[model samples]
Target chain A: MSDAEDVMIVLDESECWVLLRSHSLGRLAASAAGVIDIFPLNYYADGSTILMRTTPGTKLVEMTIHSDVAFEIDDFTDEEAVSVVVKGTAEWLDTRSAIEEADRAPLVSWLPTLKYVYVRITPTSVTGRRFVRGPEPERD
Target chain B: MSDAEDVMIVLDESECWVLLRSHSLGRLAASAAGVIDIFPLNYYADGSTILMRTTPGTKLVEMTIHSDVAFEIDDFTDEEAVSVVVKGTAEWLDTRSAIEEADRAPLVSWLPTLKYVYVRITPTSVTGRRFVRGPEPERD
Candidate 1:
């Protein structure tokens, strides 16, 4: 709307991945019964895949029904803002070996509930954008 | 996890609404062809409804196909965190009066792209959680 809002620049793929690895928290989008749902969860970025754990609930149910989902992470201060979105497919880590590896991941739940079920999202597309404020005019 | 993570408490419905009205930015989730998508957008809270504007894109197309969507807002610092989630139905304000009123809403796009189409989400469920750090014990 204003000149300040025109400073958003598209981020390259490398930039997107960097931002993803930098943030620990993000929102995961999944659909259940034709209704979309989002949950704010902590994630571990392992290579190109995003790893997270959740208990039995709507998130797990929707991921099981439909693996195609979106994951997003964003951060902003008074001066700058960055947002990254990953479109990917989710899979439950049911094997003993996979579960063992996930337990060693840096991702830790902030909630008191046990998040034992590990879900992995291998992204097909990664995109992001960054917004920065323009410099102010110099004073006389 | 540790005892520190156990400090997350579920906020009541009123607290959730209060937090929603306090924040301007949130993520909107919509599903298309069984694939879920999310977008970070700014919004205005009008009573029990969430109002936002967007250009014609995947988000608008998906909301048209299925109105059921989810909106989420959150804020956190090093010591505290708060998150609120709303599950609701999305509808385009096609009527002249609805469009006229929504144009005056406090919500404004931060991107250069034109966001003329106003959409309203009437939340059916609102939930939230707040994480606060417990007081540290005195050193021996």
Candidate 2:
């Protein structure tokens, strides 16, 4: 069990996610040096949601097996940036509708080699923050 | 719950981790947005063992809140890069002996602004991958 204080941190509005940061292409990155072969991916906005596509041997197929996964998307430069995380359940959508949506993403042109493998991240919990980097001068 | 048929990728003798290519410097590069907010961090070394430290406001702290977390770290350039991810049931280190071992990590000098908080990370399930964005193709 976690302490009440820790729970509060988990609930922090700055950076607590349910899925991961692979929802969009703002600054998408992922890795799994430890467990479950984590994939932290990101793509650009197309319409109401984010989209991602990988080749046949890619791990995106496995990510679709579970409905509950973590998704995170963020963009930061210097001091200010947006970090959005979504912890939710995902349902595999191999239907024609999902594939069409994946092909329409802006990032599709950016990386044209990938195939369609769309996984919608439904945010169970969403939180984020903004950092000012340097503190304002304190009154002396 | 994950299915047993999860497309598992085997690591060769030379491939220790599945890393991503990042340019953000140290661990910041592998983050979703190169920001300090919003992290689904997972810390894992091997099975049943935790690969994290006890630090305040760090990735491990957030993971140990009884909530499973995902961790990704990376380094990158135009041609080559590496990233790693970990997901698990984050645990904490409240004892002195555990803290001693964690403090001996080689990368501890990267950050200097951690205190008051101890260590924690949920390294229950693990995953990772590597990418080489160069001309010819690189091995993983």
Candidate 3:
């Protein structure tokens, strides 16, 4: 179903608009795709990127097998909340230096080691949504 | 790399644990997930069982396709923050009485015309991490 309302509320209002603006396209947040090792990454608006360390032989290693990925980061508050979502293509880091520069060295989460190296996400589009609490506009 | 050091320092101790304990499962400090009919539904815990509301339409429809999905709720104090990840199975609810009891139906984030429906999530595992402020963590 192509109902915009069903999946994501992509309206032209400031709330949704703010969300799209919050996406750090070149940065990535870690989330489960396979095991904790196969953590997700993202792109930043400035073309730079960010991500926590990922390990080889991890689920992340398997997930980046030339596929598209979705990355999300969000925050919520009483008056307002914002979320950023990015869709992009991903590939593994080819050189060890590139991986080190990205700060994605061998690391651990819950366990002591991971399997995957680095995942480079080339973003296609990034968007966000926000909900602001209190007050309504005066009707003209 | 199953190393615990590989973990990212997500939310501090308090916020991360709070979301894990909150009875609401969905709404709390950080409301997340895709929206419905212009309404922001915070699907929590995991998509295996979602705890959000929708009047009707594709919001409810699209999620039914796969019982598996991801739900994250995040919070922060100053520059430090953490995100909770729940990965598991999702189930759709189809009951009038049950729908009326949804969290978003009435006074909480309510809309008069909107309908209330429930998505239940049963998480297989819930994990979290965030960054610690400072130059870095000193090794133990």
Candidate 4:
């Protein structure tokens, strides 16, 4: 429930992580050169890190050049909406051990593609907000 | 229906615009300094631009510094998934006439907040992809 004044509530760190674990679909945004590119990704949140699979494509190449990226996920209903944003560093899981560990998670590309490259995002900060869905307050 | 080989198909320009208009919830990503930030927002797509309202905050401030931004929206069902990404420049609507015209849209803040500032994104390029949800292809 929301207070009368503030319809948006800031979620704690634990709450943010809980929301992250509950959803598998999200968007990853990374910048290269001067242009920013975002892609829809299906990820697995393991502990405090995010794991995803990508084929050798623009997403992997851009993140290699610029590790700093933003990942976001949101869920909405008729009564309330919640969103979580993660600012993190994305690194490819190159080691054999890392790849084996990532394989344990149920992470798979939504499309039937050959995605052997595993990428992990170590979050620098996680922020979330929950909004109570309702009509806007009247202007004075 | 998807072909037996390729599970993902690239959408054309007109197809992208139609998907953009079908949804109002999306994520906006903007970079300032060196870090990129993504925010979940509800927006109205008009003609060839996207219009959204926000209060004086980080989203507005960062866009003012670097107008270049990326916006993404996605939808998924049990059988298929679709995502659209727009790379564009964002500018705040300052003139009264511009604000008045935006007020006609069915755009409203999800929460009860004063969002008088309207920002519009004029896309330099739009890209979209549709994926048929299925299991990963077997390794050879």
**DockQ top scorer:** 4
RMSD of each: 5.4, 10.2, 8.5, 2.5
* Residue-wise C-alpha lDDT for candidate 1, range B1-140, written one tens digit per residue: 34534687899998998898888899998876666778888789976899987765545644643378888998887777889999988888789999889977777455544445777888899999897734432212
Instruction: Candidate 2: list runs displaced more than 4 Å.
Output: A1-37, A57-59, A75-82, A109-115, A133-140, B1-70, B76-81, B87-90, B100-115, B120-128, B134-140
Return the lDDT, model 4, position A123: 92
Model 2 misses residue B64 by how many Å? Answer: 3.1
How far residue B8's Cα lies from its native spot in candidate 1, in Å, is: 3.9
Question: What C-alpha lDDT do the candidate models reach, one value each?
Answer: 0.78, 0.41, 0.44, 0.82
For all predicted structures, in order, the TM-scores are 0.84, 0.53, 0.57, 0.93
lDDT accuracy of residue A10 in candidate 4: 93
How close to the true structure is residue A67 of candidate 3, measured as C-alpha lDDT? 59
Please give the distance, in angstroms, between residue B132's alpha carbon in candidate 4 and its true position after superposition: 0.7
Output the worst ten-in-a-row residue range by lDDT, candidate 2 chain A.
Answer: A1-10
Question: How would the candidate models be sorted by DockQ, starting from the highest?
Answer: 4, 1, 3, 2
Q: Which candidate is the best by lDDT?
A: 4
Write down the lDDT that model 3 would get.
0.44
* Candidates ranked, most accurate by lDDT first: 4, 1, 3, 2
**Poorly placed runs, candidate 4 (over 4 Å):** A1-5, A64-66, B1-5, B64-66
lDDT score for residue A85 of model 2: 56
